[model samples]
Target: MTSKTGAHLRLLGVSLLALSIPMLSGVAHAEDASPGASTSDEASAQAKSGIAEGSDILVTATRANELAPVTASLQATQPQSIISRSFIEDSLPATADFNQIALISPSVSNYGAANGVGLSESKAQIRGFQDGEYNVTYDGVPFGDTNDPTHHSNTFFPSNTVETLIVDRGPGNASQLGQATFGGNINMFSRATREDASAEIKGSYGSYNTWLLRGVLQSGAIRQLGGAEVVLSAQHIGSDGARTYSPFKSNNVFGKIMIPIGPDAKLTILGTYNENSFNQPDKDGATLSQIAQYGKYFSLNNDPNSQTYWGYNHTHKTTDFEIVKFEANLSPFATFDNRAYTYSYDNETLSGSDVTLYATASAADIAKANMVTLTPGGAKTVGVPGYTKTNKYRVYGDIAKTRVDFGFGAITAGAWLEWSDTYRQQRDVDLLTGNPNYVEKAVKDPVTGIATPANIKFDQNSNTNHTEVFAELELRPIAGLKITPGFKHVNFNRRIDADYNQTTRYPQKLSNTYTVNLPFATVNYEVNPALSVYGQFARGFLAPPLSYLYVADPSFSTIKPERSTNYQAGAVYHGHNLSIDADVYKIDFSNKFAQDLTAPASQGVVYYNQGAVQYKGIEGQVTYAFTQAIAVFANASRNYAKTRNPGEARTQVANAPEYTAAGGILYKQGPIRFSLIDKYIGRQWFAEGEPDAYKSNGYNTAILSARYEIGPVRIGLEVNNLFNAKPVTNISPGKTTLFDQYYYQTGRAFTGDVTLTF
Candidate 1:
């Protein structure tokens, strides 16, 4: 397989070089015709004049092999949503994760609370289905997470390493990555083709005790002969986060290289590595009173001294990953590409309680258990020490792509294959030597510290393989009007190998699974040189998450893959000073799976195929460039989504705020630039409850920033969450209700840094 794949790759490269010969000779003739600036610095000047990612569909846009988000490249399919790095920097979230960008899109909303997890549960609602179903890719390569779909993903390479982001709001042109069941797709790529060598660094501080340091490097330094171009980036982030027990550390390393094959062609190579160790304080479920007294959070495993609230859980999790990508530009207009990647995760958790150090007293001397009920970690707490679970996971994937310019139009096609394996081993201790739950033996011995008399083990192993194929046609039947149509097919084969009873209790084998998608069409009409209108019909689907398999514990097995259909229309208006974009969409879903807590805990929160749910909304975004020194950008959107279960009531998905509003302005004059951002996320539901109406806390977050650039040096300062306002998260309903859930927020924090470029 390796030799075959390699041989095909080399052949593709040779063919591309042969085709570029004619284009190269023509370019040389024109090179002397124009005596323009020839250095890297000169190219930057030319780019700023009018080279938007737009009409340049054949240039930088195709380098990453993704369908560019413009009327030109997308004419054969659907309206493509593109967010350039310039735009990303202007609306970056105060939080560390850049994936939060999903919240900035017109029809997407972030709906979730910070559970025991450190960050807000990013239960995103895109179009008419949940976010988990979307196909996420980087530089034309798929990068979806294998964790439960309901869980937030940590697979990004960070903002500094990005060039542009493409959001296909619905099922996109089906080239290989057609697995999206509902939410559709998100794609990203790095900056390439630069002739200059430069680097930059920046730092910031926020409302909480937050700090971040970032860096960027770009160049084609070795391009004089048998040349090469490269981009590299590294960053470190540490923060005293706002939530009850959230504190985190994140680090990343990324690089991309381009090697020339001929005057008009080159082979592009790219790689990325990110590792983060996040600390959790186990204060997720603490009560207001207990939170205020015990520092609001503490380690549930080690600091057994915490008596106020024994619910503390704390520890660190590490995510280590790397990816390598290669592309052969057989010619200026036609190319072939391939990529291989590996992602791994390691988690170590420790649980601590306030009642572990207690000592039993004589029957006569045991006056009484204090009226306040001695807290878990108090002087009279239980002695059962604790238990721990450690897990290791690894995932691998590879893909191949080819694009050919059939004289009439361009044909883009590709396929992706991937697999994941996991191993988990847990040990349960007898915190109290015998039965800690026994009333008489509950207390611990201060001397011996209540030794663990026995330890039980739990082990599990599992894996899955995914395969896909997709294609699209960018056709131009005539001038000014373009049409695109695409199709995709995906197959998944998975199984579980587990030992629940120390024996082969859970057998393992691959089960065949498959789905095919068709994103029929997208039409674009260029009314004039400055304005355009587009419409599309698309489909997407999301496979059942690995978590769903947990329920198959040999009993109460259930579920089906979820799916969604979408219809969208939008207009883009670009004038001399004002730019406005408007989009409206309606999405429908089938077999949506969600958490239902009303059912008992022993059974866990199971998923029920809540039939037929729908989401319809409108988004209006506007930007005004008043002058070379000042500009303003604004966006507002509303989504109306509801469960389809009849008489059973219409409920909104968790973390889905109905109205999302944003407005920001940037002022730049010479070496000084300033910016202000404000965003509003309307209230939404958080749990399965009793009331017919939903429950949520409304919130608004704001930020202030400034930067100074002199020659090759740029310095910046930013104050995030300037209002120190905590977005209302979680909901506590029913006073005096025994089952009422508690609510809280991640507090505001602050951070600062300097960078240089040459």
Candidate 2:
């Protein structure tokens, strides 16, 4: 997509959203408050005073020991738009019961689906960084899969089971320890029983043959008995699928228990199990014949204006996923999290050599049998190709923290140790013979032992142990001014035992490497009660890119970890009826992890740190209420990123949507509340050099939702991808999984839902 196209789309989206503003302007404010809602008490009075106060960002993030502070970073909680519990109840995903909305922050972006996967395997990215290069935490502890289930970390608790979510952009805090590159950390707080029990149920059905059913039952309080809360939820979804000739299904269960030790202490144990199954759909793109006949991605069999299954991209597969987690929380001070995941999948990834070929051939052979055919030489190995894969991954760790408060200021500190391991096995077989993809070409040369199967078996079982010691202190010598400084020392060692069983040779045990001392700092000044200014200067680290980790070879050694120096200044202000926040930031990135293209082809691509980049931008959001029944909000962001030197052109850096703007209005009256939102993502130059070829650019997507209530039962309708936006792709060097053509986004659709609270 070009900048012009992007700008045009943004204008169109903005106009549409603005048109609906009046639709929710008139509403009868429902004076009857929901249970647990403020009850005209001290808490209610404070909550009603500021939009930021109701965020629960501080409590969920830093686990603040006290009440709400007048000047807090709205960006701090999520630093982006929030996916509130109310939002989840409206449009649920496949693993709704055990899922929390992700990449919902300005710094985060979500693009994949959990169709054939589970909550833990859902893919995401943060701050222009791949999801794979992230550090996740369940109540502030290490959370990320080494091998088992790869990048699935969403299963610690269910969406409804969560109390709040906090996203820290850029490298994580001194407390977070793991393999994090450009992405920040996500802090998920499990529901606790400081209040009463609540039960809710929701169901929805919509376009593209979609349906969703979800329910949550939660145990509230044992406050007198040291505070105990139990929660359980289940979700089921069935969709005819997004594109042609595709259908999908999934089921998930999430449950957990929270036991408190004292007013200042707590213990938590949680587990989630998912039984998910689905068929991978084909890719979506324009075929050659279609391109010539009616332009790219066109159909002739249908009406000139209609769409055809032929233009849709398709990927086929069957996969089963599962995950379990345990976490211990010690009140407003410390937390420990451990998780285990196992998954197995089988599928035939059929990449039709070309759409034009498929189209021309089909057109030439309808009488023979209206079927698509491929030449033996047409199909190439795709992914772990003849897919038979198994993985068992685990992470066990804990942190002990203690904090002290004095009349002048407060001090906080903590340390942790983590052990992670994974076992992965993959083998591709010939769909017909049920043997390795290739059989020995019975030749006299066969004496050399059945040549290493054409389609080989590459398996690896490894263990990683990471020991980290870290600490942070917040010194507030003055009532509204504060300073924070922190540092972390981490040592990681990994051992991999790999085997090419086909050759029947001794298994190979590979050597390992490490990364050392990282420090960061930030300072803030609260000029007044309703306003504050703060600036943060810090350092961040990222392991050599994914290229190095997945395509491992001795030639690709000494992969230095990437380093970054980032700085930001922002302000937070809240008036009686409105709140606003804005920040400007820049990141000087170095030691980029890129492939060794300079090396001979015989050297094999070994990923290592080599390039440098600069990422700088500004982001902000505003919320205003005209009356208790009417509210309006807008969020905007802009970023500039490029290779440090003009010499470099393209690199699949991460999710950097150069510009984003969203606006919406929420109106509620007697049982009826309607919200209309418009979102715009500016044009992004995805790849380098081939600016005109082999790359994907950015586009704008939007959403709108409205709800009507009758007693305790509420019904709603949601319209997503209002304009049927296209999926943006990035330019990849060669044969990279991330293509210049990425996956197509979901088109415009409607979802009708019903919800009940008891």
Candidate 3:
């Protein structure tokens, strides 16, 4: 560890010790109250009513916590928001993905265009942090692509399979483990197994010829197998999409089994598989000129001779995830938990070289521009340019955590180890004949000194090894007070051996390793059972992406890992009929890295540390229950992220909204429920530090949901973009046309579903 790291650790230790000494000497008589715990009276009422605080019937309950769509727990030491499964099922569309669900939270923005909601992958930003900058975890296990710590929103766990989502708006305590912790953490938990046997069947139909069929089964608890429980589900969804010639289809199957090993121990196994196929052009959005001439939603056409043909642009993906977990309480004061997991993603895609090419160019003009000779003896052929690409990767990891309690406090320690292997390749092909455009050439392997025949754009194989270890002490010196001080060490090793590397198109082999020490401290005081206040300080770290090594020699690279210092304070309150949470945070970010687009390709896409950034924000959310059948919810955030270079003027970060807001009203009575919510994203720039960047105006979208239950049958209806709003949500400089390309949110769409429970 560096001296700076050591100094921070010392400071944290001293501060924690000083705060605990006086409280430890006092007599302790009151029972412990966790940060988010409710008052004793409220708990007693809930128990008597036989309904959990965040149950699906929350809208019908009179409790404050039950009526809130998004709220924080009283025990939070940093800014956080929790979205319950009840809210998801009652207010959001049944086909909603995690991204859509998160969009309702403060400081979050997402764009679902062309393919409509859940039909295509969507990217979401939190407090101005992009996808690869944050950490996403499922059931306490972190998973993402190896090259970059980015997630595919439509690939893994859908909303139907998730039980809860917690957005931690800061680098949490030492116990939070992931590749990128500086930005924030989006934690997703799997659905819990029920204690009662049941079965359900559902069918849904929506606009644009969308359809979904699903079935679920639960085995309750089987006494014969030591009280083992099981749950299984299968579903299929298809859509024609909102854009022209864009369609999607998916099939998913999931299963989970839990076995009790005595009263103090348990074993759990879970697995899920998904297969997805979609037709979308290579160009993600439509250029201004193309949209003006062919309509705003134009993406592809039916002409077989054109490069924009939908048949020539399609993708297929297969993914699977599995986990085995064991938990045991060795003693009254000690506990242990371990989990081993593995997941894989395989994608095969065929897409036109440029969808914008055929917008203005004639068939003959396109052929002349892309003519190629496949072999030495063959004549020049008028080929429709396209490519076939594949990305396949598998990850294996294990996590172990142990906690031991003492009279004054408790100590928690854990370690996470993971390994990933990936294979990627792309090849130029004639879209018309589905044949290679180039002749095979002999290429020698970078590692084995063996020559092989290959004709492709690029072929590469890479692997990564990651390790993290952390230890923290939770000191509860007195009743309703908790202080934690901890530290963590993270190391990452990446290696790539490419027969034909990207950009440079040459053989290369490279390896690099990064390591850092992070320190964390937090303090929480429960003023009362229904209210709590806390403060947190932590250091976050993220290693350089794999693209940093895509050079002839990686030894000379000077880019450093990104790091951040985060400080935050927050308060949470739960009253009889109202709940509210608010927080303020500031982050000092250093070693911001980006690809130097101005550099020549011969240098293999150079990456450099741009400069520093300062991020500050204030966020809050509230829910008020007017009656057992009516409630109101609201949240807002003011965020500012500015880049500070040595000599350049400070500029706003790209895509960082100035502010965000959401409000809605919900009603539930008898066997009926209804909700209407609206979300707004404030002004933002399209490019960082660019003089000619486009500034987008703020936009608003609303969604309405209604459901009715009769006996064992339930019916639901959802309308997204209820007012038929169409606004540009994303923009990028065009590659083929002089005008910029824009992506707009889909217009009004409706979905209806009927479910039967037995």
Candidate 4:
């Protein structure tokens, strides 16, 4: 290990040792007590006096059940963190999403930019893996965009509907299914229906002119429907975002029902519908010169003559998700489960070209420069050149699994099949007149041998079919020990039919299919009731993204699917007043892909396998309760990822933080609760495979929250970015100007909420 790595390890060791000192001393004192003394009697006396014996610290139900914002499971086979619903109710803001809730976990980093938390789509990274490198699932079903496996954090499930979240930091066992599973998995589960009937109304108001209102109704178990329980909720939220001329609003509705069939089976049905609308400029950030001339928050203007007008750039999207699941116990030793699901996303957007390019230019100037009004008869009086883009898709899928238990071990097998249909198109238009400003071109159809005139940029349709089959066996040869081995086969088929191809602007039809097999194994041992250790080895895989198939000639493409070999081990300890988990991991990544900058324009962008990469990291988290009402929590990670080439020196991966740390103090008593947390992100490069890449400095932010409850009413207040620290978090290189664009975190903000339950 390098000197820096050694130092990090040493620091982590010291921190863990310090946190264990109190527990260790208590255990030692208990062991040295008089033999004649009754241990049970002593423990009872300590409990009655609010004092805890070292040996019985966590033995009691109260201390063992103490709430921790982020914790580990004693039964986990890999490095994982569990965030419970109780933490969300008391700690996070009502407007929070999955990304905001994940901020407290180890080895995770995200900056939402000027949109504020949960106000817009945000990208988050795990370890050194980017957004599309990992997997995300709701309940147990995987969902994402059809073109690539990327998620929009604000468009789907909200915090109010979530019950629990698990961050699995590895390629899970063979039963885990998704488009990408090598980096890790973020699993989210919905809230369960309540047994008793109840109703609730909630409202919240916050900084940046944000507000939210929600209502919920729960139906108690009914004998008329086999003791079925149902829950329904509706909410609306609106915000004037941190950036100038950018606003956001959304409305959502959710419903769930559970029915007990016979005495050995159950059925569940759930559905969600949402509509979102926002106004934002095409360019996300501002160049340094623009920032200096305007302001850090400058994005769009009210002027109709410029391309940065907010009225000329806006988007509207609608989404829906539905699922039906059935589970049954076939016999005392066998069980079966199946789920059928469908989801869709429809988006329509109008955005202008680069704002900086036309910052001071006029419509006549643009026409003279041939930037707009390219057609022979197109009008030159139209101002603000832009485009109309649309993306609409729907997905259908099913998952079925069965498990059988024997005296020595258990077997699990599952299969997943999914299909998706998508249509996408983009066309240049005059923002003022709402008229198409197409560039006429005569292109011959390669297959039909017919020439036609086309005006639009591109119009295409695609279909994808994905299939996965997996089986695993869990063997328990001895007490307190278990071993699991499994394998999974994956196949993907993609087909595209385009009236006008993207860059080459030609009619084409193409299809491609890829297949791979992956294997996984893990061993876990329980040393005692309070401690456990585990190790895992797995092979991960990901097929090439959709963009790789955009070339003019598919036969000449040589791109390959990405793959990784992972090895990791970890330990978990839960005792008396403390809970701790730690792990170390290494991954050998190959078949990395990068765009070929030298490719000719006529051929469109081409991709090639660049080289291999080595990723290694250490991660840990600890929580200690000083008393029944107060606790302290801390977590840290040191990550290293570098590219490896034939005769080149290793370089750091772009957008991957060097290190991350978070800590906080939490207090929970009778009817009041409070917490203060701070998170830190380390330095990172903004661009990869470029000479003299720009590097961003590290930064940290803090939040404070408090809550109080009385009878059926609950009130909460949260202060974010308490110190008002604003630092650059992202950069986009300029294509024409010498100065690059930068994106910064929003300043301090506050929120207050109230809820009434009946």
TM-score of 3: 0.89
Q: Would you give me the overall lDDT of model 3?
A: 0.74
The digit string of per-residue lDDT tens for model 2 on 165-207 reads 4455555345444566245555554443224578879887887
Where in model 4 is the C-alpha error above 4 Å?
1-65, 358-371, 374-382, 439-455, 596-605, 689-693, 736-739
Better of 2 and 3 by lDDT: 3
How many clashing pairs per prediction, in order? 50, 19, 4, 0
Give the poorly placed runs of model 2, Cα more than 4 Å off: 1-83, 90-104, 107-110, 113-125, 147-162, 191-194, 222-227, 262-264, 281-385, 439-451, 501-506, 545-556, 600-607, 649-655, 694-698, 726-742
Relative to the unseen true structure, what is the C-alpha lDDT of residue 750 in candidate 3, on a scale of 0 to 100?
93
Which rank order by lDDT, best down to worst? 3, 4, 1, 2
lDDT of 4: 0.73
Better of 3 and 4 by lDDT: 3
lDDT of 4 by residue, 328-350 (tens): 65765566768899999998999
Query: TM-score of the candidate numbered 1?
Result: 0.75
lDDT of each: 0.50, 0.47, 0.74, 0.73
What are the per-residue Cα lDDT tens digits for candidate 3 across 1-758? 11221121111011111111100001111122211112111121111211100111111122555666777755566777777776787788777788888888899987654588888888888888888888888776888888999988888876667767777788777878788888887777666555568998989999989999988898877878866778898888899988889898988888987777765566778898988899986556877767877787877789887777899989999999998977665665566668899999999999987766544555555666566556533676777778899999999999887767676887778788999999998887888888876634545554566654344768899999999998878788888787888889999999998877764456777788999999988887878766778898999899988878777656545678999999989888867688888989999999988767787655545677878988899999988889877889899999988897789888778888889999998887778979999999998877778444567778888999999999999899999989898988878766533546778888999999999999
lDDT of 3 at 306: 74
TM-score for every candidate vs. truth?
0.75, 0.74, 0.89, 0.89
Worst 10 residues of 2 by lDDT: 20-29
Q: Point out where model 3 deviates above 4 Å.
A: 1-62, 359-369, 376-380, 439-455, 595-605, 690-693, 735-739
lDDT tens per residue, model 1, 1-758: 11221121111011111111110000100111111222232222212111111111211111111111111121213334445454445435324333455555555555333421123334455543456666566555555455443333443455655665555566554552534635666565555435566776766655445666777776645736455667787877675554444556667777766565544334455666665555443223443433444434322223332321223344555655455644444554455556677766666754432221221222322223211212333344434444456666788887776666554456667777888887765544333332222121232222345522123234567677888776767565766565667666767755666553122223223232545555655666656655567777767667766556554232343456676677888776555456566778888887767655576766644666666777778877666667755667777778777777756777765556677777777675677757787767776675542243436556766767677777876666666556866544554443433323344434443334455666
* lDDT comparison, 1 vs 4, better candidate: 4
